[model samples]
Each structure stands twice: as C-alpha cells, then as structure tokens.
Target: MPKTFYQFLMTQRNPESYDTIANFANNAFLDSAFPKQETEFDPLSKYLEENAPYLPSMTIFDDAWQLYLASLA
Candidate 1:
C-alpha cells in the first residue's frame, strides 16, 4: 500500500518540514475563520489578527514548532 498525504507529511525530512509548517498555518487560519463560539483567549478573529505579524516568520518550521511548544506552557 502507498502512504497517504498525512503519512507522507509526518515522515518528511529537513527542508520539507517548511512545507508542513505552511500547510498547518493555512489550515489553522481556515478553521479559525468560522469558530463556534467566542471568549477572551478563544476569540478566533482577534487571535488571528494579533498573530498576523508573526506569519512571515512562521514560514520556518523551527519557529512554528517553537510557537506550538510555547502555546502549551
């Protein structure tokens, strides 16, 4: 059997990680556009707007990975 898109993405190497970061950023923006409810930290629109400045820098997989780790702490 062949690897699916998700499987391929998960197994990507070095420079290919940048592409995965881009895809994750795109999906996050799309999902946040139509959020189910709103709250202080949960306000999708505001969160997206505030994070817009970081988008360009986020193109790097390492930066995006760090951001994800920071969010968890």
Candidate 2:
C-alpha cells in the first residue's frame, strides 16, 4: 500500500531552509484532520493556508510538493 503523505513526509530529511514546513509536518503528524491521504497539492495547500496561517511562507510546501512528486517516479 502507498504510504500516507504524512508518513512519506516524515521520512524526508528536513530542509534547513524550510524549517517551518518541517515543523508543520511534525505537527501534522498529530493532526487527525490533516489530509494525510491526499496526493494533490491544491487541497493540501488550502488546508495549510487556512489551518496554519502562522506559517511564514508557502515556498516550503512548494518545494516539498516537488520532492513528493519526484518520489513517485
């Protein structure tokens, strides 16, 4: 079975430049409402923007999304 997004994320080396995303991912591991199963970026981005407005930037999510997509290849 494919791993959940959060599961896949946890295996990643946390990027130093994107510490907030790493922190968010760590916290997301505990959020039952986080869409861990979703593969698309839109909903995931929306979730973060709405639920985690404190994140300083979305660049990390964009970077991580690229990594996630590459992992599938």
* CA lDDT of each prediction against the hidden true structure: 0.42, 0.72
Per-candidate TM equals 0.25, 0.72
lDDT for model 1, on a 0 to 1 scale?
0.42
For model 1, residues 1-73, the per-residue Cα lDDT tens digits are 3332223323333433456565555554444443323322335335545654434443344544454445445
Top-TM-score structure, candidate number: 2
Q: For candidate 2, lDDT tens digit of each residue in 18-61?
A: 56657656666666778878877889899988886545678877
Error of 2 at 58 (Å): 0.7
Q: Worst 10-residue stretch by lDDT in candidate 2?
A: 12-21
Alpha carbon lDDT at 64, candidate 1: 49
When summed lDDT is taken over every stretch of 10 residues in candidate 1, the lowest stretch is: 3-12
Q: Give the TM-score of candidate 1.
A: 0.25
Which regions of candidate 2 deviate over 4 angstroms?
13-21
Clash count, one per candidate: 0, 0
